[model samples]
Target: MFLGKVVGSVWATQKEVGMEHLKLLLVQPIHADGTDAGTQVICADRIGAGQGETVIVSRGSSARILISKDSPVDAVVVGIVDSFEYCKE
Candidate 1:
Protein backbone atom coordinates (compact mmCIF):
# COMPACT_ATOMS: atom_id res chain seq x y z
CA MET A 1 0.00 0.00 0.00
CA PHE A 2 1.02 3.65 -0.50
CA LEU A 3 0.10 7.00 0.97
CA GLY A 4 -1.39 9.62 -1.33
CA LYS A 5 -3.54 12.70 -1.53
CA VAL A 6 -6.85 12.77 -3.42
CA VAL A 7 -6.38 15.54 -5.97
CA GLY A 8 -9.55 15.34 -8.03
CA SER A 9 -12.42 13.19 -9.26
CA VAL A 10 -13.07 11.59 -12.64
CA TRP A 11 -16.49 11.39 -14.23
CA ALA A 12 -17.51 9.09 -17.03
CA THR A 13 -21.09 8.66 -18.05
CA GLN A 14 -20.28 5.74 -20.24
CA LYS A 15 -17.74 3.12 -19.28
CA GLU A 16 -17.27 -0.59 -18.95
CA VAL A 17 -20.01 -2.35 -17.03
CA GLY A 18 -17.77 -3.48 -14.19
CA MET A 19 -16.28 0.01 -13.75
CA GLU A 20 -19.49 2.02 -13.99
CA HIS A 21 -20.45 2.41 -10.35
CA LEU A 22 -17.03 3.00 -8.87
CA LYS A 23 -15.76 6.52 -8.23
CA LEU A 24 -12.39 7.43 -9.69
CA LEU A 25 -9.91 9.88 -8.21
CA LEU A 26 -6.62 11.34 -9.29
CA VAL A 27 -4.13 10.79 -6.50
CA GLN A 28 -0.65 12.11 -6.10
CA PRO A 29 1.71 10.22 -3.84
CA ILE A 30 2.90 12.13 -0.82
CA HIS A 31 5.40 11.85 1.97
CA ALA A 32 4.34 11.41 5.57
CA ASP A 33 4.89 15.12 6.18
CA GLY A 34 2.32 15.93 3.47
CA THR A 35 4.80 16.93 0.77
CA ASP A 36 4.31 15.90 -2.83
CA ALA A 37 6.25 12.85 -3.95
CA GLY A 38 6.07 13.80 -7.64
CA THR A 39 3.94 10.91 -8.82
CA GLN A 40 0.31 11.00 -9.90
CA VAL A 41 -2.02 8.00 -10.20
CA ILE A 42 -5.70 7.41 -10.91
CA CYS A 43 -7.35 4.88 -8.62
CA ALA A 44 -10.83 3.54 -7.99
CA ASP A 45 -12.19 4.93 -4.74
CA ARG A 46 -13.79 2.19 -2.68
CA ILE A 47 -13.90 4.37 0.44
CA GLY A 48 -15.40 7.62 -0.84
CA ALA A 49 -12.39 9.81 -0.19
CA GLY A 50 -12.57 13.50 -1.15
CA GLN A 51 -10.08 16.01 -2.49
CA GLY A 52 -7.26 17.01 -0.13
CA GLU A 53 -7.80 13.97 2.07
CA THR A 54 -4.85 11.77 2.88
CA VAL A 55 -5.66 8.31 1.59
CA ILE A 56 -4.20 4.86 1.57
CA VAL A 57 -3.89 3.28 -1.86
CA SER A 58 -3.54 -0.38 -2.59
CA ARG A 59 -1.51 -1.13 -5.72
CA GLY A 60 -0.65 -3.90 -8.13
CA SER A 61 -2.65 -7.11 -8.69
CA SER A 62 -3.58 -7.48 -5.05
CA ALA A 63 -5.27 -4.09 -5.16
CA ARG A 64 -7.94 -5.36 -7.46
CA ILE A 65 -8.68 -8.38 -5.32
CA LEU A 66 -8.90 -6.29 -2.22
CA ILE A 67 -11.76 -4.23 -3.60
CA SER A 68 -13.78 -6.99 -5.12
CA LYS A 69 -13.75 -10.71 -5.57
CA ASP A 70 -13.79 -10.25 -9.33
CA SER A 71 -12.65 -6.81 -10.39
CA PRO A 72 -10.05 -5.61 -12.89
CA VAL A 73 -8.97 -2.61 -10.90
CA ASP A 74 -5.20 -2.08 -10.79
CA ALA A 75 -5.29 0.41 -7.98
CA VAL A 76 -7.79 1.41 -5.32
CA VAL A 77 -8.21 3.74 -2.37
CA VAL A 78 -8.84 1.42 0.54
CA GLY A 79 -8.71 3.76 3.48
CA ILE A 80 -8.33 7.35 4.63
CA VAL A 81 -5.41 8.10 6.90
CA ASP A 82 -6.40 10.31 9.79
CA SER A 83 -2.87 10.48 11.22
CA PHE A 84 0.58 9.23 10.25
CA GLU A 85 3.31 7.74 12.32
CA TYR A 86 6.87 7.01 11.28
CA CYS A 87 10.05 6.36 13.15
CA LYS A 88 12.84 8.59 11.88
CA GLU A 89 16.31 7.43 12.49
Candidate 2:
Protein backbone atom coordinates (compact mmCIF):
# COMPACT_ATOMS: atom_id res chain seq x y z
CA MET A 1 0.00 0.00 0.00
CA PHE A 2 1.04 3.63 -0.55
CA LEU A 3 -0.16 7.21 -0.21
CA GLY A 4 -1.11 9.23 -3.26
CA LYS A 5 -3.20 12.10 -4.57
CA VAL A 6 -5.64 11.74 -7.44
CA VAL A 7 -4.18 13.92 -10.18
CA GLY A 8 -6.51 13.08 -13.04
CA SER A 9 -8.97 10.59 -14.52
CA VAL A 10 -9.13 8.11 -17.39
CA TRP A 11 -12.00 7.42 -19.75
CA ALA A 12 -12.22 4.30 -21.84
CA THR A 13 -15.31 3.63 -23.84
CA GLN A 14 -13.80 0.41 -25.08
CA LYS A 15 -12.30 -1.74 -22.36
CA GLU A 16 -12.33 -5.31 -21.17
CA VAL A 17 -15.62 -6.59 -19.80
CA GLY A 18 -14.20 -6.84 -16.30
CA MET A 19 -12.91 -3.28 -16.44
CA GLU A 20 -15.98 -1.55 -17.77
CA HIS A 21 -17.50 -0.73 -14.38
CA LEU A 22 -14.41 0.64 -12.73
CA LYS A 23 -13.46 4.30 -12.55
CA LEU A 24 -9.83 4.81 -13.45
CA LEU A 25 -7.78 7.56 -11.90
CA LEU A 26 -4.31 8.97 -12.36
CA VAL A 27 -2.51 9.21 -9.03
CA GLN A 28 0.71 10.91 -8.04
CA PRO A 29 2.54 8.99 -5.34
CA ILE A 30 3.30 11.00 -2.22
CA HIS A 31 5.58 10.49 0.71
CA ALA A 32 4.33 10.38 4.29
CA ASP A 33 5.50 13.97 4.57
CA GLY A 34 3.31 14.92 1.58
CA THR A 35 6.04 15.28 -1.07
CA ASP A 36 5.95 13.81 -4.53
CA ALA A 37 7.62 10.41 -4.47
CA GLY A 38 7.55 9.14 -8.02
CA THR A 39 5.78 9.07 -11.34
CA GLN A 40 2.01 8.88 -11.54
CA VAL A 41 0.11 5.60 -11.77
CA ILE A 42 -3.34 4.70 -13.10
CA CYS A 43 -5.54 3.13 -10.43
CA ALA A 44 -9.04 1.66 -10.46
CA ASP A 45 -11.37 3.42 -8.02
CA ARG A 46 -14.23 1.67 -6.23
CA ILE A 47 -14.38 4.09 -3.30
CA GLY A 48 -15.38 7.15 -5.29
CA ALA A 49 -12.08 9.00 -4.95
CA GLY A 50 -12.14 12.26 -6.84
CA GLN A 51 -9.40 14.34 -8.41
CA GLY A 52 -7.14 16.13 -5.90
CA GLU A 53 -8.20 13.91 -3.02
CA THR A 54 -5.67 11.97 -1.00
CA VAL A 55 -6.13 8.19 -1.34
CA ILE A 56 -4.59 4.92 -0.33
CA VAL A 57 -3.48 2.69 -3.16
CA SER A 58 -2.92 -1.03 -3.21
CA ARG A 59 -0.85 -2.63 -5.92
CA GLY A 60 -0.25 -6.08 -7.43
CA SER A 61 -2.41 -9.11 -6.63
CA SER A 62 -4.05 -7.39 -3.71
CA ALA A 63 -5.32 -4.69 -5.99
CA ARG A 64 -6.77 -7.17 -8.41
CA ILE A 65 -8.65 -8.80 -5.56
CA LEU A 66 -10.48 -5.59 -4.75
CA ILE A 67 -12.77 -6.15 -7.69
CA SER A 68 -12.16 -9.81 -8.26
CA LYS A 69 -9.40 -12.31 -8.81
CA ASP A 70 -10.17 -12.18 -12.51
CA SER A 71 -9.98 -8.40 -12.70
CA PRO A 72 -7.36 -6.84 -14.96
CA VAL A 73 -6.42 -4.15 -12.49
CA ASP A 74 -2.90 -3.90 -11.16
CA ALA A 75 -3.50 -0.89 -8.95
CA VAL A 76 -6.55 0.24 -6.99
CA VAL A 77 -7.58 3.15 -4.80
CA VAL A 78 -8.58 1.30 -1.67
CA GLY A 79 -9.50 4.19 0.58
CA ILE A 80 -9.94 7.95 0.66
CA VAL A 81 -7.82 9.58 3.28
CA ASP A 82 -9.55 12.10 5.49
CA SER A 83 -6.40 13.43 7.16
CA PHE A 84 -2.73 12.69 7.66
CA GLU A 85 -0.16 13.70 10.22
CA TYR A 86 3.58 13.17 9.89
CA CYS A 87 5.94 13.32 12.82
CA LYS A 88 9.29 14.85 12.02
CA GLU A 89 12.40 13.49 13.57
Candidate 3:
Protein backbone atom coordinates (compact mmCIF):
# COMPACT_ATOMS: atom_id res chain seq x y z
CA MET A 1 0.00 0.00 0.00
CA PHE A 2 1.04 3.61 -0.60
CA LEU A 3 -0.13 7.16 0.08
CA GLY A 4 -1.25 9.20 -2.89
CA LYS A 5 -3.25 12.25 -3.90
CA VAL A 6 -5.74 12.09 -6.71
CA VAL A 7 -4.46 14.37 -9.43
CA GLY A 8 -7.03 13.78 -12.15
CA SER A 9 -9.31 11.21 -13.76
CA VAL A 10 -9.20 8.86 -16.72
CA TRP A 11 -11.97 8.08 -19.16
CA ALA A 12 -11.81 4.95 -21.26
CA THR A 13 -14.55 4.50 -23.77
CA GLN A 14 -13.55 0.97 -24.68
CA LYS A 15 -13.49 -1.31 -21.71
CA GLU A 16 -11.59 -4.49 -21.18
CA VAL A 17 -13.35 -7.56 -19.79
CA GLY A 18 -14.24 -7.17 -16.09
CA MET A 19 -13.13 -3.53 -16.16
CA GLU A 20 -16.32 -1.86 -17.32
CA HIS A 21 -17.58 -0.68 -13.92
CA LEU A 22 -14.32 0.48 -12.42
CA LYS A 23 -13.67 4.23 -12.06
CA LEU A 24 -10.13 5.11 -13.02
CA LEU A 25 -8.09 7.89 -11.41
CA LEU A 26 -4.69 9.45 -11.92
CA VAL A 27 -2.83 9.54 -8.62
CA GLN A 28 0.40 11.27 -7.76
CA PRO A 29 2.47 9.10 -5.45
CA ILE A 30 3.16 10.86 -2.15
CA HIS A 31 5.21 10.37 0.96
CA ALA A 32 3.86 10.74 4.49
CA ASP A 33 5.19 14.29 4.55
CA GLY A 34 2.96 15.18 1.57
CA THR A 35 5.74 15.21 -0.95
CA ASP A 36 5.98 13.49 -4.30
CA ALA A 37 7.47 10.02 -4.05
CA GLY A 38 7.40 8.75 -7.61
CA THR A 39 5.63 9.02 -10.94
CA GLN A 40 1.87 9.22 -11.09
CA VAL A 41 -0.19 6.06 -11.46
CA ILE A 42 -3.64 5.22 -12.77
CA CYS A 43 -5.71 3.41 -10.18
CA ALA A 44 -9.08 1.72 -10.10
CA ASP A 45 -11.55 3.02 -7.52
CA ARG A 46 -14.85 1.63 -6.20
CA ILE A 47 -15.38 3.81 -3.09
CA GLY A 48 -15.97 7.14 -4.84
CA ALA A 49 -12.76 9.12 -4.52
CA GLY A 50 -12.45 12.42 -6.36
CA GLN A 51 -9.65 14.74 -7.33
CA GLY A 52 -7.46 16.13 -4.50
CA GLU A 53 -8.46 13.46 -2.01
CA THR A 54 -5.80 11.57 -0.12
CA VAL A 55 -6.27 7.84 -0.57
CA ILE A 56 -4.65 4.59 0.42
CA VAL A 57 -3.71 2.46 -2.59
CA SER A 58 -3.23 -1.28 -2.70
CA ARG A 59 -1.21 -2.79 -5.48
CA GLY A 60 -0.79 -6.26 -7.02
CA SER A 61 -2.95 -9.09 -5.74
CA SER A 62 -4.04 -7.12 -2.69
CA ALA A 63 -5.76 -4.65 -4.99
CA ARG A 64 -7.96 -7.39 -6.36
CA ILE A 65 -9.17 -8.58 -2.98
CA LEU A 66 -12.22 -6.28 -2.80
CA ILE A 67 -13.37 -6.98 -6.33
CA SER A 68 -12.14 -10.45 -7.11
CA LYS A 69 -9.00 -12.44 -6.59
CA ASP A 70 -8.57 -12.71 -10.34
CA SER A 71 -9.22 -9.09 -11.19
CA PRO A 72 -6.75 -7.50 -13.56
CA VAL A 73 -6.47 -4.28 -11.63
CA ASP A 74 -2.95 -3.12 -10.87
CA ALA A 75 -3.99 -0.60 -8.23
CA VAL A 76 -7.09 0.03 -6.13
CA VAL A 77 -8.15 2.70 -3.63
CA VAL A 78 -8.55 0.95 -0.30
CA GLY A 79 -9.22 3.88 2.03
CA ILE A 80 -10.18 7.55 1.88
CA VAL A 81 -8.00 9.36 4.33
CA ASP A 82 -9.73 11.68 6.80
CA SER A 83 -6.68 12.75 8.77
CA PHE A 84 -3.07 11.69 9.22
CA GLU A 85 0.07 12.84 10.94
CA TYR A 86 3.62 12.64 9.64
CA CYS A 87 7.04 13.95 10.60
CA LYS A 88 10.42 13.60 8.89
CA GLU A 89 13.15 15.21 10.90
Candidate 4:
Protein backbone atom coordinates (compact mmCIF):
# COMPACT_ATOMS: atom_id res chain seq x y z
CA MET A 1 0.00 0.00 0.00
CA PHE A 2 1.09 3.60 -0.69
CA LEU A 3 0.02 6.87 0.94
CA GLY A 4 -1.32 9.59 -1.35
CA LYS A 5 -3.69 12.54 -1.72
CA VAL A 6 -6.60 12.92 -4.11
CA VAL A 7 -5.53 15.69 -6.47
CA GLY A 8 -8.15 15.28 -9.17
CA SER A 9 -10.56 12.95 -10.89
CA VAL A 10 -10.80 10.83 -14.07
CA TRP A 11 -13.71 9.81 -16.24
CA ALA A 12 -13.96 7.04 -18.81
CA THR A 13 -17.30 6.49 -20.44
CA GLN A 14 -15.79 3.73 -22.55
CA LYS A 15 -14.28 1.40 -19.99
CA GLU A 16 -14.65 -2.29 -19.48
CA VAL A 17 -18.22 -3.22 -18.61
CA GLY A 18 -17.18 -4.71 -15.29
CA MET A 19 -15.40 -1.47 -14.33
CA GLU A 20 -18.10 0.98 -15.37
CA HIS A 21 -19.46 1.82 -11.92
CA LEU A 22 -16.09 2.48 -10.26
CA LYS A 23 -14.95 6.08 -9.65
CA LEU A 24 -11.47 7.05 -10.85
CA LEU A 25 -9.22 9.60 -9.18
CA LEU A 26 -5.84 11.21 -9.68
CA VAL A 27 -3.69 10.69 -6.61
CA GLN A 28 -0.44 12.43 -5.77
CA PRO A 29 2.00 10.54 -3.63
CA ILE A 30 2.70 12.15 -0.26
CA HIS A 31 5.43 11.89 2.34
CA ALA A 32 4.83 11.04 6.00
CA ASP A 33 4.78 14.78 6.73
CA GLY A 34 1.98 15.31 4.12
CA THR A 35 4.20 16.90 1.48
CA ASP A 36 3.92 15.99 -2.20
CA ALA A 37 6.55 13.46 -3.30
CA GLY A 38 6.57 14.33 -7.03
CA THR A 39 4.78 11.16 -8.03
CA GLN A 40 1.17 10.86 -9.10
CA VAL A 41 -1.06 8.04 -10.32
CA ILE A 42 -4.67 7.37 -11.29
CA CYS A 43 -6.48 4.83 -9.18
CA ALA A 44 -9.96 3.34 -8.89
CA ASP A 45 -11.81 4.55 -5.80
CA ARG A 46 -13.35 1.86 -3.64
CA ILE A 47 -13.89 4.27 -0.76
CA GLY A 48 -15.51 7.60 -1.71
CA ALA A 49 -12.46 9.84 -1.18
CA GLY A 50 -12.70 13.45 -2.34
CA GLN A 51 -10.11 15.89 -3.63
CA GLY A 52 -7.44 16.96 -1.09
CA GLU A 53 -8.15 14.00 1.14
CA THR A 54 -5.19 11.81 2.13
CA VAL A 55 -5.75 8.23 1.06
CA ILE A 56 -4.23 4.78 1.11
CA VAL A 57 -3.69 3.05 -2.25
CA SER A 58 -3.27 -0.58 -3.10
CA ARG A 59 -1.75 -1.57 -6.44
CA GLY A 60 -1.72 -4.62 -8.71
CA SER A 61 -4.08 -7.55 -8.22
CA SER A 62 -4.40 -6.64 -4.56
CA ALA A 63 -6.10 -3.42 -5.60
CA ARG A 64 -8.88 -5.36 -7.27
CA ILE A 65 -9.35 -7.49 -4.21
CA LEU A 66 -9.90 -4.32 -2.22
CA ILE A 67 -13.14 -3.72 -4.14
CA SER A 68 -14.27 -7.27 -4.39
CA LYS A 69 -12.49 -10.48 -3.63
CA ASP A 70 -13.65 -11.88 -6.97
CA SER A 71 -13.09 -8.80 -9.18
CA PRO A 72 -9.88 -7.27 -10.63
CA VAL A 73 -8.51 -3.76 -10.29
CA ASP A 74 -4.95 -2.68 -11.12
CA ALA A 75 -4.96 0.14 -8.57
CA VAL A 76 -7.45 1.19 -5.90
CA VAL A 77 -7.94 3.83 -3.21
CA VAL A 78 -8.83 1.90 -0.10
CA GLY A 79 -8.78 4.30 2.82
CA ILE A 80 -8.97 8.01 3.56
CA VAL A 81 -6.65 9.21 6.29
CA ASP A 82 -8.27 11.62 8.72
CA SER A 83 -5.25 12.97 10.55
CA PHE A 84 -1.50 12.59 11.14
CA GLU A 85 0.48 13.71 14.19
CA TYR A 86 4.21 14.21 14.27
CA CYS A 87 6.19 14.64 17.48
CA LYS A 88 8.54 17.62 17.55
CA GLU A 89 12.20 17.08 18.26
Leading candidate by TM-score: 2
Mark the regions of model 2 whose C-alpha exceeds 4 Å error after superposition: none
Ranking by TM-score: 2, 3, 1, 4
Write the number of the candidate with greater TM-score, choosing between 2 and 3: 2
Residue pairs in steric clash, candidate 1? Answer: none
Better of 2 and 4 by lDDT: 2
Evaluated with lDDT, which candidate comes out highest?
2
Q: Which of the two candidates, 1 or 3, achieves a greater TM-score against the reference? A: 3
Estimate every model's Cα lDDT from 0 to 1.
Answer: 0.86, 0.94, 0.92, 0.85
**TM of each candidate vs. truth:** 0.86, 0.96, 0.93, 0.83
* Total residue pair clashes for candidate 4: 1
Error of 4 at 40 (Å): 1.0
lDDT of 3 by residue, 29-88 (tens): 999989899999999999999999999999988887777777788999989999998866
TM-score of 1: 0.86
TM-score of candidate 2 versus the correct structure, residues matched by position = 0.96
- Name the lDDT value of residue 85 in candidate 2: 89
Q: Who is ahead in lDDT, 1 or 3?
A: 3
Model 3 vs. true fold: TM: 0.93
RMSD in Å for model 1: 1.7
Off by over 4 Å in 4: 68-72, 87-89
